[model samples]
Target: MWAVSAKRESPPVPEPLAPLIDAHTHLDACGAETAADVTAIVDRAAAVGVQAVVTIADDLDAARWAARAADWDPRVYAAVALHPTRADALDDAAKAELEVLAARPRVVAVGETGMDMYWPGKLADCADPAVQREAFAWHIDLAKRVGKPLMIHNRDADDEVLDVLAAEGAPESVIFHCFSSDAAMARTCAANGWMVSLSGTVSFRNAHALREAAAVVPAELLLVETDAPFLTPHPFRGAPNESYCLPYTVRALADLLDRPAAELAEITTTNALRTYGIG
Candidate 1:
C-alpha cells in the first residue's frame, strides 16, 4: 500500500542526457492501461534519454499486464513476481502462472520479491514474515530456473533479506531494487556481487545514508530506476512519478559523485542492459 497524498503536478522533464535505462518502474501504476498509454509513457521517457524501461509486476493481473506490455512496446521489458506484501497471494496457481510468465522472453527478471518487515505487523493483509520468506525462496529458485536476474524489494529487513539470500543460494544475478540501505550494506552488496538499483529516493534531501551508500557502490554493481507512481525525486516529492523523471535522480547522483551526468548515464545503462540481459 502506498501512502499517497494530495496530488501535485508532475515535475518538469529534465534536459536529455546520454542514453539511459530505467532499471525498474511500474507502468500500470503510472496509469498506463493500453498500448497507446505505454507508447506515450515510453516516448516521454525517450525524449529525456531514458531509452528503455523495465516495468515490474506486483500481483497476478499486474504480472499479466507487465508481460504483455513488454510485447506492446519495443522500449519496454518486464519483471514478474508478487510484491512481498502480497506474498500470501502466491498460491499454487499463482506460482504456476508466475513461473510461466517468468519464462517469457520479454519478462527480464523475477522480482520485486524479497522482504517487507515494515508492513507485516502494521498491515493486517500483509503476509506473515514466514510466508514472505518462503515465497522469497520460491521466487529466487524460479529466477534461477528461468535464468534471469532476481530483483529484490527489501524494506526494513536488510539482515533478514541477506540471511534468506544466503540460505537459498542466491540466483546467478540479484538486484536490490530501490536500495534503501546504508554504506555498510552497499559495501556488502558489492562484496557479494549483488547489483544495487537506486531509485529517486536517493535525491531526497534527508536520504543522507542512501546517498552515502550510492557513493560507495561500485559502478559495475550500480543501476538506476524510477519506481514510478511513487518516490518522485526531490523538488517534486509529492508529485506522481514516471519513467521520464529518472533524469532528475541521475543528475543528482552525478552531482553527489562529482562526475559528469552523461558518464553516469552511460555506466548505468550498460549495467542495466547486462543485468536484464537485454539491449
Candidate 2:
C-alpha cells in the first residue's frame, strides 16, 4: 500500500510502523461527514499503525463537528480554535461558545491559533497582525484557563509569534504545529521547552532548512502530524492526504534524523500522548 496514484484517492498507506498518533488533521476537510466517515478514516489510519489522531477545528462549524467526531470514534480527539487568518470572527459570542467547546472532555488543546502574516496583505479579509495577535493571546489564555496545551499555527511570522508569547506569557505547555522554520527557530523552541510538531512538508527535497531544523529537535520535544488534506509528503506531494499517510512523514523524519523508524515512532507517539494529555 505504500504506492498510490496521483488521483483524488487517499495516498497509499505506508508500511505500518510502531503505533503512532497524528497530532493534527482536518477530518471535515478530508470529506468526512458522519460517524461512518470518521470510522472509515480512522480505520484506514489504524491499518498503518496510526492508532489515534487529533482532528483540529478551523472555525465554529468545524469545532462543533470535531467534538462530534471525537464522540463518534474513540481514536479521534479534537482541538478547537479559529484559525489566525479568521481571527476577526472571534467576537464576544464566538468566544463564549469557543470557551465551552474548549472545556470539553475529549477536546485536547486550544489551538491552530497564532499568527499568519502570510495572508494579511495578500488576502483582503485576512486578519492583520494586531487582530491575529489579540486572538492568539486570547487562545493562550483559554489554554491556560482550561489547563491544556496551547497549539500554535504560525505562518511567515516566526519572530512576531515568539514576541507575542514572550509579551503575554506562554502556557506551561506550548506546541508549534506544522513547524516550518529553520534550525535557529527550532533551537529557540527547544530551548524554551516548547513542542515542535513537524508535517509532510519536511519530506520535500527542497526543504533543506526544514530538514536541518528537524535534525536539531530533541527527541522528547519532537512530534509529528499529517496536516492532512494538505502538505502531502514528497513522492506523494500534490496528492490528497489523510491520516493514513502519516507514516510517510514519520519515516521521512526518521531518515532526516537518522534514527530507526520504530524508534522515532515510539518517541513521537509518547510525546503526542503527553502533549495532548491523552493516553
Candidate 3:
C-alpha cells in the first residue's frame, strides 16, 4: 500500500518567467468564492508571470459565476460548460443559459466537457454514460456554433472522446486540457493539430509517461496550466495550488523535457495565446 502525504503549504515560488496563461482552472473551486477573490487570485498569478487565466465552469452555477469572475479581472477569461460528471445537470434550462454565457465577451471556450468513467461505479454524482455522451455532443455543437475552441476533459474514456470528436467533426480549435494519457495518444492528438495542455500532474514522480509525452510534443502544440487548487506539482503535490504556483510545474516539466524553464514558459505562453485566441 502507498500513502501520499496530506496537503501542506506550497514552497516559495520560482523566479518569474515570461508571461504565462493558464488554459484551465476553477478559481471558485479553489476558494475564490467572490468577485473580489478573482482579483486576489489573479494578483497572485500575475506576480509569478501568469498574465491571464481561463477559469472553467464545472456546473451551471459555476458557468454563471465564471463569466462574472472574468469580468472581475482583466487577466481573467472564462470557459463555460457542464463538466462530464455533471452531464445530467445539462437540462434544457441549463443549456439555454450556457448558450448565453458561451457567447459572452470574456468567455473564450466551451469546455472541461467530455467523458469520465472513473466516477461511474462508486460515485453517486456520476453521470450516466448515455447522458454524458448526449451532453458532450451538445457541447461540441455549442462550441462550433459559438466559433470558439472546445476544451475536453477525459478520464478513462479517451476512446469515446475521440470517437465523438470524429463523429461530430471537431471545432477548428481543440484543447485537451490536463492531458493525462501517454506519448502515443499525445502524438495522435498533435498530428490532428489539437493543442495539448499539460498540468501540474506532469511533475509527479509517478508521471514518467506524461513526461515522455511532453518531451515528444512539438513546441507548437504544447501548452501548460496550473489546474490549480488540485494536482499541485511534485514537491508540492499535497499542497493547495493557486495560479502563482504554476512556475513550479513549468520548472519540473522543463527538467523532464530537457529544456530551460524560461523556454518552456515562453513556448507555453504563446501556445496558450493561440489556443485561447487571445490577441
Candidate 4:
C-alpha cells in the first residue's frame, strides 16, 4: 500500500443527489489500494448517487493499478497517461508500456495529461515546461489513435494547452478535466467543442474566477468531478475527499450555474456517458 498519513480521515456522508459521474480522480492517491478498498470507496460514492467514476493514472504503476481497479469494479473506468508534472520520465520503455495499457478494456480515455507549469523547478520530480509540452503532444496523438477522449490537466498553462491542442488538432472529444481558467478561456473551449469539467475548486469562496468560468460554459459542454484527495468542496475543503463527497461539488455547481441540482446531475451524467462512451 502507498504510504499515507495516519490522520487521513474520509469525509462524512452528504445527502444523495441525482446520479452523476466523477470525470476525473485518482483511486490510489485516495488511499484505496486494494480490491476491497476500491469497492468500499465506490460503495460510499454510490451512497451519494455517484454512479460511476473515471479514475486516472499519472504514471505506469498507477496506470497498472487503475486498469485493475476498472476490472475489479464495473463503476470504475480508467484513464491512463503520464501526467505533465512527471512527463520527463516518459522514455521509450514507458511509452511502449503506456501504449499497451491505453488500449486495455475499461481503460476508456487517454489522460490527466496536458501542460502544468506549477511544479517544475519548484518541486522534486516535476518535469520542465518543455518536456511537458512534448509529452502533451504525444498523449494527444495516443488519445486519437485509441479513439477516446483526451482528458486534459492544465495548471498555470491555459494558453499553452489550447495552443498544443490546436496545433496538433485535438482528439474527437477533449475534456478539460478540472477546468479552472477564466471566462474567456471557458468560452474558447465551448467554441472549439471541448468539454469543461468543474471540480471542487469552483466552490471555493476565493475562486470567483472559476465560478464565472462555470457561468459562461454552456450546459452541454459542462462536467463535474472532485479531483479527490485534493480539491474537496466548501465546508469540507480540508477533508480527505472521496467520490462520496461529490454531492457537495455538484450542489455548488447547480447553485452557481442557476440550475436545480437534480436537473444538473442528470445533464452531467448524460454528458459523462456520452463523453467517455461508458456503458
Residues 29-65 of candidate 2 have per-residue lDDT tens digits of: 8889999999999999999999899999988889989
Model 1 global lDDT (CA atoms, 0 to 1): 0.93
Please list the residue runs of candidate 2 whose C-alpha ends up more than 4 Å from where it truly belongs after superposition.
1-9
Provide the overall lDDT of each model, using Cα atoms, as 2-decimal numbers.
Answer: 0.93, 0.91, 0.87, 0.89
Segments in model 3 whose C-alpha atoms lie over 4 Å from true places? 1-7
Which residues of candidate 4, in runs, are more than 4 Å off?
1-9
User: Which has the greatest lDDT?
Assistant: 1
Clash count of each predicted structure: 0, 0, 0, 0
The residue-level lDDT of candidate 1 at 81 comes to 99
Candidate 3 C-alpha lDDT tens digits along 177-266? 999988888998988999999998998888778878888788998888888777787787777778888888888888888889898888
- In angstroms, what RMSD does candidate 1 have relative to the true structure? 0.8
Q: Residue pairs in steric clash, candidate 1?
A: none
TM per candidate comes to: 0.98, 0.96, 0.96, 0.96
* Tens digit of per-residue lDDT, candidate 4, span 1-279: 113334756667889996889989899998899999999999989988999999999988999899999999999999999999989889999899889999997999998899997777778878888899999999999999989999998998988998898899999999998898999999999999899999889889899888888999988998899887788888767767778888999898888877899998999999999998986
Best by TM-score: 1
Query: Which 10 residues in a row give candidate 1 its minimum summed lDDT?
Result: 1-10
Better of 1 and 2 by lDDT: 1
